[model samples]
Target: MREFDYDLFVIGGGSGGVRAARVAAGETGAKVGLAEESRYGGTCVIRGCVPKKLMVFASEFSGLSEDAGLYGWDVTGGAFDWGRFSTRLNGELDRLEGVYRKLLSASGVDTFDCRATLKDPHTVSLANGEEKTAKHILVATGGRPVRPDMNNADLGMVSDDIFHQETLPKSILIVGGGYIACEFACILHGLGVEVTLYYRGAQILRGFDEEARGLIAESMRERGIDLHIGTNIVEMDCAGSDDSDTGMGGPIQDTGETVGDSGMSHRGRQSGDTSDGPIRVKATNGSSRVFDRVLFATGRRPNTDGMGLEELGVKLGRGGQIEVDAYSQTAVPSIYAIGDVTDRVNLTPVAIREGMAFVETVFKGNPTPVDHALIPSAVFTQPELGTVGMNEEDAREQEEIDVYCTSFRPMQTAFIGKPDRVLMKLIVSKANRKVLGCHIVAPNAGEMIQLAGIAIKMGATKEDFDRTVAVHPTMSEEIVTMRNPVRSA
Candidate 1:
């Protein structure tokens, strides 16, 4: 082997890449070099989740004036300067980038700003034509937004592009059926925009507990969002300027192709430029609508492009994700991948864990497997939805499971006299009574699930949750005090 400059070389300085670099170089005392084409903090920190949620908070306050009046506050119609909010998100992100830099530097890992492309199995070439070699090359370049293949998609935007939008769009048509799509629906709705969310399916979210999905849909409608659950966006027309008929002339798709034994392919997604009152949308049944701005919150594809791993014989799996074993090792012995690049579980924390594990197994010589079974996720809608472990439907479909679920109006709603409702459900194994899943839809449900996740992962049962003392004056108490229960539902 040639004498190399570093022990481990990483491409893409996102959550996983930076973490692995830090642990391997600092803790394991290995010489590590990290190459990043973008910001150090990666997608979740830079453009994906953090800044987007910040925008959500800003947008939500735009309509809060209406609710404040109910609490004996006086206010009139108000306007929000979205440019100002975008600036704030950017400033905060700039500070975050500095912190990531400091953290990586303190770990003694060298950083490269140019793009990295693997030449041979172990050699990497930079964009500026600098060649470097390492014993191991880790591909942690997370995912990127998939813009529609319509005319001037460049004019349209994806979830990542919306973080630092030039200005707030008065009306937005978001496309896709995923958590990001639903989360964006709630965020943009809260932000006081005429937001119309289009999901190709009968519902918005997929892979979530179905009951919670229904609750979210209802909550979004209650919060005044124009949600079209069984619809899609076929094409976006940006010929006019941002101000010219802000909602005019966008095409929709008619997915005439039926779902086969596997699923429907893009070949069946036919396009029709039918207009819907100046906004743009596409229905499965030959329909079209229009909007001011378009957001493809649909999903993300790994940033495995232009970073030459294919020629280097790196393996990739489903959805163009870099292939890795339990410890995140790639097909090539020295190459490994983590985070969205690996696409195992495309969450921020999961990538961080993979990064930590990669160091342990590769550098420390003591391997640790990534446990993804009980990973938790939160959709920060106006009323949040949080879940961990096997959901009721998933548990039932996968294995024989007992369902213990209850939902009721919180005390806040009783006093406020609002039509909002909070639902909580638990799925336990019929064979052993171990808590298989926990789902909640309420204010701060995400935060409540954080503590409950531990108990669920520890194999707690319905009886244990029932026996636990309730904390007064909190919505979380409902989790432990579920009065009604059915054996099987």
Candidate 2:
């Protein structure tokens, strides 16, 4: 048998890769080598979840100050200092990156700070001109936010760029109606930015429970986000230029090469002047506007380009996601993949679970299949949304379901004369009496759904939820108190 450099070679330093590498090395005592070209903590720790939640907490203060007065506490709202917050956020991220490095090192996994790509089925090539062979290779490259191929799209920023902004814009036009777009729109608005949101779809928060999303949309509007539905940007250019229609000029063509999956070009000039000018924008709705910034929270694609995977007979999807079986094994049995790169669940915790499953299957001589079902998720919109299992629309398509839902003004908000309302909903399977789904739209909904998720995951029945006595005067008590079915399908 030919001797390989290591027992395993893992690519990408994100959650999946690091977890797989460390577990295989520490627990299974596999000779693992992991390589990461950027920060080790990956998207969730470095850019996606942690920093975004901090911003969410910062944004909540504006409402907290108002609610304080209603509760007989004298609290005053103050201006948010993005500079100070961002500085501290960056420092915290740096500390986290260090922790990831330390964990990998202590696990006895050899770490490489350079990009690594597949040279062949068993061979790997690094950016620093190093070549190594492994018995098994894993790819967890993850994904990146993408902008649509519209005119002057480069002038817009993606979700990743939001963290690196030097300062907050006085006003911003946020495009797309997905969770990322809605979350940032709320965060920016809370931080005192004049936020405007545009979505080409009829409504925001698509793919969620209709009733829950409806309440979230109404709450977002009440919070003062200038939301426009069924709309999109057609053209954009720098303000103060008189070149063509809309008094701003034609679309600023992307002359530079595309970078990664983000759909951004390096050579396109910015859409505004250096002296604090707004970017001219023309929307499909025949509306023209000028804004300090245009943020495209449009969508994201898998990060698979230029990685040499396709050349190695690793099947890829239309979105560049790796084609994997239940074990995350690619067509090439020696190769496996997990996390966003596989496009399975696309959640950080799911990615970690997939990674651990991969290690158990490959290293421990035990075949483990990842379970992607009944995973709870939360969207950090102003009111927030927490959901688990099948939504109403999807459930009704396959089986008869009873929807038990309630929407009411909470006692706290009612005391303040606030128009805010919360929603709690349960979708129960009629045949099995099992709680097929649970959705909540309210403050701290994310925290609430976590406990609810445990019960639903265990196949808890509607009677099980009923037997659990309700906690009085709590918003979550509505979850258990909702007995009568509002509708059945």
lDDT of each: 0.73, 0.84
Highest TM-score scorer:
2
Tens-digit lDDT track of model 2 for 147-230: 667656666787777888888899999888888888999999999999999888888888888888888889989989999987
* Candidate 1 wrong stretches, greater than 4 Å: 75-77, 234-288, 487-489
Q: TM-score of model 2 relative to the true fold?
A: 0.94
- Candidate 1 CA-lDDT value: 0.73
> What does the lDDT read for residue 121 in candidate 2?
91
| RMSD for each of the candidates | 6.1, 4.0
lDDT of 1 by residue, 10-128 (tens): 88787778888888988889999988876778777787668767866776676557666766679785777777777777899899889988988999988888778888877888887
For candidate 1, the per-residue lDDT at 3 reads 88
